[model samples]
Each structure stands twice: as structure tokens, then as C-alpha cells.
Target: MTYGPDTVSASQPLLQLRSLSHSYGSVQALHGIDLDIAGNEFFALLGPSGCGKSTLLRSIAGFETPAHGEILLDGEPLTALPAHRRPVNMMFQSYALFPHLSVEKNVAYGLEAEGRGKAEVRRRVGEALETIGLTKFAKRRPGQLSGGQRQRVALARAIVKRPRLLLLDEPLSALDRKVRAEMQLELKRLQHEAGMTFVVVTHDQEEAMSMADRVAVLNAGRLEQVDTPVALYAAPRTRFVADFIGTANLLDGTAAAGGILLDNGLVIAADHTLPSGAAATAVVRPEDVALAGAGTGTLSGTVVDTFFLGGTSTVSVQVPGLSAPFTCTVRAVQVPQRGSQVGLVIDAARTVAVEDDRAASRPGAAQETVSS
Candidate 1:
């Protein structure tokens, strides 16, 4: 297929970072990060608050200099280019709009700085506003717009100059849930329309999963895994990824011929082979845990907590000897009442085992995705 500049796909990278590393004093923020973005790809750098997602984005944007590594755009090294000289634009989480300027003026700011003729600026600004469905609000200031509208104004400003790449830092964090959902669709459309690479840094897992073609997960200044959201969720290579990307229940047990045998007299069949005497932890999502009749199941427990979410319910069961309660996510209609006796059943094919290297046991080992 033809790539950028009416050339073949083998021409060059749209954006490339080679062995990028950054540090603040003695604390390292990013360590040897290598990534590439093809033309028009929507990529996300996702991790928790201190994982340095934002730091990496800033480094790529020229806001921060890396102690090592190189940054390239359109196959050209960007080592010597300043932020203003590089063909890149950033939309900050705060929607950094000029409160005093009208929406049209804000959108035209970059074009004006480039000394474009007035008529050309008008044409580009008009088109940008129309593309974002803000043509009528062009005369309004940022103070007159809602959070979502202001965000749109910022995006229009960034894309009006036709930058080669766009960087967004938590661009949707300020909007309400409904507005955020609407803007997500808008951002996707905008990316396709501009036909430019869009790299976003977010702590929100669902946001990253919904908008990105690929996600690069980081933790404590290190790259964990880079893959599509489905693959990251389905087959996490490390225990941290398995626990961080979704709600999971980790059951510590002794390795056996079939699987790992729990201290509670329960055995989980896993896919990987482990030393017969090794201690392993079984990772299973709450949604995979099924409830059955007490006398006909693998393990039995007492229902202690039930959350009646719309269309579904999350129930937590207390089992003896386990440090924390085991939770099961089931349809609201399929759950039993609180204080009732219940049986927990796990599907053999869905569970995986990881070696537990920390303290032998801990209470409430249930894991959750980031962006909370």
C-alpha cells in the first residue's frame, strides 16, 4: 500500500524513538524506551500516575530532553529542533486555550504566527471549525464554551497548522462521562480526517483501549509491553500487566501434576507447566468465576458482599483460610442474595498461573485496571 508522500510503505517511519531515556535528578523517569508510529496510527502510552507516560510524551514533544536516545519525525532526526521548529503540536490536559481570544482567533493562532496571508488563514480556520462542528461558535470565547467545546477548540488550533504529528496529554480527563464519550468519537474522526499520527498519554485504560491502535504500557520508568488492547488484556506477558489491566483474583497454591492446588483444598487447571513443588498463583478474572450449587462445585464459600450494577452484579464471597474474599462478577439476574451459601467454579481454560515471589500471602489480592 502507498504510505505518506505518495510513496511505498518501505520509505521511512512516520515517527521513531530509539532507546529513549530520561531522568530527573537521581530518579529515572523513562529507561531505554523504543517505539515507532506509522502514518495515521493512533497510539497510546498508558500506565499509572507515576509510570512516566506523560514524561515520555513531553520528551517526544521536545518539552523535555532525554539523557539518551534519538527522536525522529518523517525519518528525519529531531535532535536539534526546538519545539516550535518541529512539525508537532500538543494539546494539553487543561485545554490551554486563550480565554481572551475568540474560538476562530484561537484556531488561527498558529497559522497567523506562520505569517500566512489573511485569506488563507481564514480559509483554514473556517475549515477547521467546520470539521469540529464549531463553525457557529467561532465567535465565542473559551469562557463561553463547555469543557468539551473548549477541548474541541484546542484540537482545532493544533490541527489547523497541519502538523505531521499530534500529541495529546489526558485530553478527555476534564469532560463529564457523556461528554467524554462523545469527544472520543470526535477525536477518532479527527485523526482519520487529518491523516496524521496521533500519540496520546493517558492513565485511563478504557480511554486508551478505545482510541489507540496499539498501547505501550509502562511502569516505574520501564516499558512493560506494547500490543493491541485485546492482546494485552488476553495474554499479558508479565504478572504486573495481568494484574494491572483488569480485575483479577490471584489464588496462591502449590504446583501439582494437573495444576496448582490451593491451601483451601481447591485445584485450578492451568496452561503452563510449573515445578511440582513450586508455589504459584492462579490469575482469574472475576467475570470468569462461576457460581454453582454448593455440594456440586470445586469450592464453597459464603456470599458476603453484592454490588448491584446495572445489568450485572459483582459478588464477593468469604472462604475460610484465604486472606481476602474471592469475588465473582455475574449478571444481576444470575446472582444469589447476600449472607447466602455459595459455590465458586472456575473454567479451566481461562485461568493462568504465575509465580508469586513476594510475601507468601496477602489479603485482597484482587487487581484493577489503571485510570481510577
Candidate 2:
């Protein structure tokens, strides 16, 4: 399989970062981040605010120079290249469309800067507008279009340049939920059709999970885990990833003979043998724990709350051993009333053991491939 320039594949590294580190005075932002972004992949850098996700994206875009690192795009060192000289384009959070210019002119801005022939610019701009489904809106100005349309115009402008890599910083943060959802699919379609690598930096977990092929979860300037959304959710590698990726019941426990012994002395069967008597935590997803009729299961708790969410409802059960009530997902039809007793049967096969890394857990919160 030929890669780079002609056709790209998962085995081909289009963008690679090695020993990337950045700091702001005494505060370290990124600490030795190494990533290999495959060709034509939709990759996401996810983390909360101030976790250096933005800093990392900026470094790749040549906006912020890293304290130490190297960025290579298709085997070419990009760290030394200026933002304008690099074969990349960054669509900022604000869209940054020129309100005074027509949509066609806005889309033609990048080509015009490079001094392309007028006819060539027009042809490329027309193709980009058509690709982004904005051909009819070409004559309209930014203020004349809706929020989503304006975003498309900005995207058209970026793609018109035919950059090898596109860096989008908070690409959908400004749109409403419905528009954001629509744009998510649209972005995926656009990326697939274009066959260009996209590195999206986002704090929205839902956006990242729903859009990208793989997600790199970051926290406090450190790499937490890089995996597919399903793996990140079902098999988190650390406590921080478990807490940030999805709703998790982190029950403090001690590693003992059979399993991790909870505060109430209940043992949750674990797949790995932990250091005996070491302090640990059991990470359990809400959907993984099943609640049944009381006295018919291995564990029991009193229903503290029930959240009705269309097809499924979450049941929060207050157990004596767990600090926070364990949440179990049940069909909306099976939601029990609050204050009712229920039994929780955990599927041991779904549970994974990892180090108790709560110190990395903090409220912080992007896409890849058509298929690999």
C-alpha cells in the first residue's frame, strides 16, 4: 500500500511528534508527549482547559513554539516552519470569516495570499464551496448567512488551500446542539471525501467520541490514554481516564485476596492480581452494573434517584460500601421508583483494573478515519 502524497494508510505516519514538551515559566503544560498521527486519519486531542491541549495544537500550527519537540508532516520537519509557510491550516474557534467579503471571496482568501492565478483561485474556490455544500451561498456575506453556514464558509476557505493537514481548534464549540450534531456528521463526510488528515482539538467529550476514529485523552499536561472511544469507555487504563471519559463509580478499596475489597468489605472480582493490601479504587461504568429485584442478586442497594432519558434510565443506588451512589442503566420501562431496594449484578468480564490515579482526575474535557 503506497502512502503519503498518492494514498495514505493507518500504517503511514503523516504527523509525528517526538518528545514534545512545553512550559509557561514554572508551570509545565505538555510533558514529553509522543504521538504518531496516521495518514488520512481524524485524530483528536482531548483535555480540559489549561491541560495544554490548546498549547499542543498551537505548537503544531506554528503559533506556539514548544520548549522542546519535533513535529514532522509527511517526513518533513514542520517545527521550524512558520505558520504561513507550513503545509497546514488552522480553523479557529470563532470561524474567522471575513464579514465584509462574499462567501466566494472568503473561500478564495488563502489561494489569493499564495498568489495563485485568478482563474485557478476561482476554480478551486468553486470546488471547495461545492464540496462543503455551500455553492449556492457563494455570493452571500458572512453576516448574511446563519451560524452553520458561516462555519462552512470558513471550512471551505481552509480546504481550498489543499493543506496536507488541517488543525481545527474547538471547531464546533460555537454552534448549538442540533447544529453541532449535524456538523459532526458533515465534518466526517468532508474528511473522508477529502482524504486529508485532521487533528481536532476539543474539550467536548461527546464531540470527540462521536467524531474521531481514535481519541487521545489528556490531563494536567500528561497523556492519560490514547484509544478508540469504545475502549476508552469500556476499558479505561487509569482512574483519571475512567472519570473523565464517562460516568464512573470510583469506589475506594484495598487490594486483597479475592479482589479489590471495598470500604464495606465487599469484594468486586477483578481480572488482575493487585499488590496485596494496597489502596486502590474500582472503576465501574453505570451501564455495566445491572440492577434486579432485591434479594435475587449478589449486591443490594437502595434506589436514590432515577433519571429518565428516552430509551434508557439511570438508577442511582446508594450502597453502604461506595462513597457515591452507584449508577445503573436500565431500560426506561424498568426504572424503579426512588427509595426502592434493588440488587446490582456486576459483570466481572467488563471490569478492568488500573492504578488509582485520582490526582490526575479533573474536570477537563475531537476525529479520524472513514474506516481503517
Candidate 3:
């Protein structure tokens, strides 16, 4: 199952994108995107709709040619190669499977088209089906299988090709919520077992955070930030990333001695290196905001509402001098009554300070070194 080296050297990346850009007529789809993905790593391209994540995936798959830049696989350039000529396999969101073909035939279709011998095709197909745990259902057609099973069949077909890289475009979007969750783990397991490099394009922040070793966030055809899920969530370098990654209570202010100074003269202590008087934003997570007795913490606020979510409750507090309500996730058992005054204790160490300018942030400017 293992394919390449378990550990990739820092000197070289398996897939390299340099000044990559593409456009359709006057509509620019991709900016100068620079990225490096190591072998045997599960990387995700994450962004909202029309962010060029899909376009980037298609560029790598050889389906869309870029207007400029070079794509390198291993050490060779892949720009001149056709989609079929490249050593890459892409699985679409639809789980495109032949309805008339049995599981075995479907899995073997690529090999058969490659002119591989019947014996070799059968051997590879059997191994693939076994790896996917679908040996018992090899004779069944795509229509006979459940959503998850059909997804597995598509996975088996893609992996049977043993391509150097596997690209998935919202692979689990077709499944229900429960099944999508299951397949997330399944996809990770398969990637590890097969020792293949996986590049998944997704708009789901939770999905990318849960599955990828590293994620690259794109915005308006521009690369925003690229880092590990933990670093990306905990220490976003820009305002757009802070807002997009998860639920962050963004406080816009000016940089001060040790934190960001709000317009109301309250300085929220956070970690940052910005010069004093510069524009900044404090990124605070809901979980890090603790509710305390009024006048006991940094800021006092009135509880606007409370949403019970099983083990946790999200409390919205309306504070003076703030434009929007600040949200805090607290234990459901300690739910505070609405209209009650409460103090907000934001953890200084967990809170991050990011630049407020949306257009100035680059992909790797403030990112920590992430392993493949």
C-alpha cells in the first residue's frame, strides 16, 4: 500500500506551483498562486464559491490550462501534458460511475482502456476492491449500491490506477451529513493505507480542517494563506481568513503596545507584532470567551440570547461601544439568563491579532512551517 517515501525532505516538494494563473476571457480565475504539496500528504484547497479553488484543481488535473506559470510534478514540468497523459487521477463530486458496469468492471475500466492484460486487470481490480472492503459486492451495479458504497466503488476505481496524485473535487458532497462524516475518515484512512498524495478541493471549512494535513485558503482568485489546520485556525494572518475559517469575534481597532486598542478606549490584549497606531483586528474564538460576573472581567455586557446545543450553549452578549453582539460558547449546564449582565473574559494568549487590510495578505507571509 505504501507508495513513496514516508517522509519528504524539506528541500523538495512533490507538487510545485509557481506563479500559477489562469483566466477565461476577461474574467481572471486565478492569481499568481504559489504552492508546494509533498508526497503522501493529504492537502486541501479551501475557499468559498468563485474563489478559484476548483479552477486550481482543474489546472493541476490538466483540464484547464493556465495563462501563465509552471506546474511541476516531482521535478518535471506538467504544463505541456494532456489530461490523459498526466500521472494524476481526479474524482468528481458526482462519484461518476458507469451504471451498466458491475463494481469489478467499473474498477477495471481504466486498466482495460490502458490495454493492460485481463489477468493483470483482474488482479489489480481484486486488490482494489479488497482495499475498499467491497469484495462481496463486486458483482453489483452502481444502482444496486448505497451512497457510501457507490463512493467507495469510485474511490477503488481511482486508486486502482495508482496515479502519482489523486485530486478530489468535493468528493463527499453527494452524500448525506452522517455518511459524509463517515467518508471523511474513510478517505483519510484510504490515503494513509495507499500512501498516495491527495489534493482535495472543498468549500467546507470543517471538512478541510478535519481531513487535510495542510490547507490553502483562496480569495478572489488570490492565495490568502497556507498552513496547517491548527495554525490556520489559531493564528490567521489576515481578516478574511479570520472570518472564513470559523466563528471568530473580530474586533477592529488600532495596534497598541501589547494588543489592539478599540475605538472606545478599551485595549484587548492579544499577541501581535504590529507597530503602534497601525490598523489591526483582534481574532477571538467563541470558545475562548468566558462568561463571568459583571465588572469582574475586561468588558461587561448584557446577554442578548442563548442557544442550547446539547453539551454547549452559544450565548450572544450585547456590549456597549461594539457594533455587533459578541458570542461565547459556554457549558449548557451553566446557561446564563437572557438580559442578565455578564463580563466577557477573552483569553489573551489564545486571541490573535491580524492585519485588517483584506488585499495585503499573502499565502506564506505569516504562516508557520508545516510538514507534509
Tens digits of per-residue lDDT for model 3 on 134-183? 99999999999999999999999898988889999999989999999999
Q: Model 3 segments beyond 4 Å from truth?
A: 3-10, 359-372
Per-structure clash totals for the candidates:
0, 9, 0
What are the Cα lDDT values of the candidates? 0.82, 0.83, 0.90
To one decimal, what is the Cα RMSD in angstroms of model 3 from the true structure? 4.5
- Show the colliding residue pairs in model 1: none
Tens digit per residue, CA lDDT, model 1, 230-307: 888877765677878877787888787788788978777887777886877788888888999875565678999999
Using TM-score, give the best candidate's number.
Answer: 3
Which one is best on lDDT?
3
Candidate 1: segments with Cα more than 4 A from true spot: 1-12, 253-258, 261-265, 273-280, 355-372
lDDT of 2 by residue, 196-241 (tens): 8889999999999999999999877778899999999988887778
